[model samples]
Target: MKKKKNLKKIILILVASVSIFALIIFFCSFVMIYQDVKDNCLEAQKEYGDDCVDSLIKIVQSQSQTYRLKNSAIWTLGQLADKKALPFLYELDKSLLPQKKCDLDKYLCKYEVQKAIKWFQKGNITSWMYGNRESWH
Candidate 1:
């Protein structure tokens, strides 16, 4: 009876450990996949030029897009550092600044727009690629 109980405890501990390890792997995979998509989008913009920028601008302008999607578009524009996007970005930055309190979804989008505008002004496209989020806000 003692041996059976100890075996069961060991098995339970092993199962729990495996489950946690699987979860960590799953999370890391998801992050890698997301980063790959972003990297691909940036590459596409570089290769395609105006077409990609136009599409990203449309995404930013689209009210139908979720805040996350819009924020992604804004970040991409910042990365591209195209002069054409500055007007639209300026408009967005100004619009977001009036709101003292942002809903959770809009807050990050607002921050991204602000960052993009700064990047445009400073012409710091390279650093924006590997930007440290802590210094921006």
Candidate 2:
């Protein structure tokens, strides 16, 4: 009976150790992915220039298989939204992509353009505080 209890204890410890290891791996992967998304966002902003918003949207929409990538894409898109992208954003879907609108808008790849517009709207409110007050005069 004592031997059986010892074996069970060993098994339990092994399982716990494996679970902890898996958690550590998952957390490391998440951190790595987050950093990658941040880098991609910065790159999209810098390299794409006029195309950065569209490129970012495409990256987010295309990489929808991973929740981390998808979420980052959405966040990035929100950062770069523009009015020109709305029509395209409204058109995409999941069948063509993964996170489409109407479950289908994923096909349209202008997500960042749409998102950037929204960000612009919000940013515009603060613009008034910083710009030349003399310009109005």
Candidate 3:
């Protein structure tokens, strides 16, 4: 009986440790993927100019994409600074506000939309991070 109990406990510990590691890995993947989406969108905006618009919009609308990725797409739209992007950026800004109160990850999303709108208004279109960055054009 004693040996059987020790074996059961060992099995339980192994299963628990595996479950915790798997959860950690899954959650970490989302964090990494979101950051990658943001960076890649920014790079594409910088490199492709107006050509990136359609693809970025698709990412924003795609069901598979996360809020973090959509937010990055919104920022890229703002950075791209095209008049065509105004409505999308504005819509994102409107949608983001309510989410802010419920989700902590939304602060960047809210900030990016507001900054995009501000730059869109100013006709400067720089990132909120540097405000008045050297023009990409």
Q: What is the C-alpha lDDT of each candidate?
A: 0.67, 0.51, 0.64
Model 2 lDDT per residue over 5-82, tens place: 999999999999999999999878665644554565566555444354575666555544444545455554443344
Q: After superposition on all CA atoms, what RMSD does each candidate show versus the true structure? A: 9.5, 12.2, 11.8
Model 3 — TM-score against the truth? 0.47
Model 1: which ten-residue window has the lowest total lDDT? 128-137
- Per-residue lDDT tens digits for candidate 3, residues 1-137, read 99999999999999999999999998786556545545655555554443466667776776766777677776666665667778877777777554434342444367767877787788652333333223322
Q: In model 3, which runs have C-alpha deviations exceeding 4 angstroms? A: 1-50, 98-108, 125-137
Candidate 1's displacement at residue 109, Å, is: 2.9
Query: Which residue pairs collide, candidate 1?
Result: none
Compared with the true structure, model 1 gives a TM-score of 0.51
14-56 per-residue lDDT for model 1 (tens digits): 9999999999998786566446435635544454454556767
Q: Model 2 reaches what TM-score against the true structure?
A: 0.43
